[model samples]
Target: MSVLVFAEAINNKYKKSSLEVVNYGAKLASSQGSNVIVLTNASADAAAELGKYGAQKVLNFESDSLHDNKMLSQIISDVANSHNADTVILSDNSKGKSLAGRIAIKLDAAAVSSATTLPNLEDGFVVQKSLFSGKAIGHYQMKASKKVITVAGNSIGLEEMGQPVAAEAFDASAYNATVEMVETKRVEGTVPLPEAELVVSAGRGMKGPENWGIIEDLAKTLGATTACSRPVADTGWRPHHEHVGQTGIAIKPNLYIAIGISGAIQHLAGVNHSKTIVVINKDPEAPFFKAADYGIVADLFDVVPRLTEALQKFKAS
Candidate 1:
């Protein structure tokens, strides 16, 4: 049996979450004494890069129309059957989550989504996952002969070996899709928040959107993506895509800096998974301070510009 991973790509490159999933699948495959195979909708050239992360073979599906879950599930099931895949891994992103259930049904596999840690295959297919917004952990065992796992985004570390492997093209000419291509809109220039290692997020405590220059300056200096609290997005102070909360995007960046945010539970639920949380606020008793690795109780207007200058000097050196 082999371990198969669905690696998603954007703009001709694999997304960070996809790479993390590949690394995780590689580790699991090693433990199972099986080969790792990565299936991606990227070009053959781009798919070849998966070798560095321990993929033995890369299956390149060149069609963008294959993004549909129903079509992708069927294709994935066919590939898994060919490889005799005992384990199928997917990134817990929007697309992966949607496809996991469908693929599980097609393969008659027990599926687990948002798994935080790799499965313990020696004792059965038991996987550890997060629950209740990261407040609790659950261990689940899959009884099916095959298993489907969607790994939590940013939960797995990427391991690259500085090598490349050739990719084989997958023939999908017989698959008929009901969906048509539509216009796509994307935010350009800035790093994607989902994949960013560093994130600089702000809230209503910043006073007004007109005074957002310091936030932009600091983020630019540190090569970070910018984010906002749910209220900030609702009020149009920031775009809705930048919102992070219980109802917004959940992130687990290496470094998360919060400026002027009060640390509401909804907001904390989204960002509490960050490796290091640095909170800056005028209020000394803000709830965010409890969760912060480092906290500065001062005016962001005074503290942010100085921090930006310091980072700029460091980068220039």
Candidate 2:
């Protein structure tokens, strides 16, 4: 009856999606009248922070094989068996998706991904998920002794409900890892687009890379990450990491501001999960206007500078 949450840490802290999944697991555990446990690759001391997100116990596995999905799945499966946990929760990210299937196979459990809502325990173990790239919702009833669920990003809310609990050490050395450790490259300073609350993005309409000063200024003013559409990234106007579209990175920011972008369907797919969308374009018939919560029909050259100025002034005041 216990629920185990995989708390993936990024840049020495828990990612937003992982925290949200932990909260969701906590709620699920509460519904089942069981305790929620969190497993992490972070230091045992750092796992204590997860307790505020409603984790009753945190299991910290210190290993260099954090990037090895096979080893991680083996660790998770072993922990689930040890605790007799019926449900395992993870964020629907790359690592989670890869590990979930393996864990399910190893534990002889049912695995569900892209879950948007919590399971309905009153009836059968029915969970709601987004299908066809978030165009539709599908409800699935998993009839298995154990279950693995990977929750969608930004689909659930986070609430802190408990005091910080000490993290216990977990030994994962017994499991043989198929992959070896390699050099790690860590990107620092900038806010990760996936975890950002606010994002300022642009597209080809901005003209060229030299004109990116306004976009950067606007992002700095709003404390937001900077993103670009597929075309913009393709043309090298911005780095590929800044790209947001069907073929690029998917984001779910609280506030998304787009300038000089025509909002193609592919681009919209990546940012459609944003809570508030603001678009500024010269074309009145721009497709982005249709999806924007706020639209301004004006030249971005004129509109962006003024907007950035206003934001800076407001912050100063």
Say which candidate scores most in TM-score: 1
Evaluate all candidate structures by whole-model CA lDDT and list the values in order.
Answer: 0.88, 0.88
Report lDDT (Cα) of residue 272, candidate 2: 83
**What range of 10 consecutive residues in model 1 has the weakest lDDT sum?**
61-70
Error of 1 at 53 (Å): 0.9
Model 1 reaches what TM-score against the true structure? 0.96
Cα lDDT of candidate 1 equals 0.88
User: In angstroms, how far off is 189's CA in candidate 2?
Assistant: 1.6
Ten-residue stretch with the least lDDT total in model 2: 129-138
lDDT tens digits, residue span 207-299, model 2: 999999999999999999999998888888799999987788888889999998998888988888899999999999999999899999999
Question: Whole-model lDDT for model 2 versus the true structure?
Answer: 0.88
The regions of model 2 sitting more than 4 angstroms off are none
Please provide TM-scores, in order, for all candidate models, with all chains considered together.
0.96, 0.95
Q: List model 1 lDDT by residue over 149-182, tens digit each.
A: 9998767677794378999999887887766658
lDDT of 1 at 72: 82
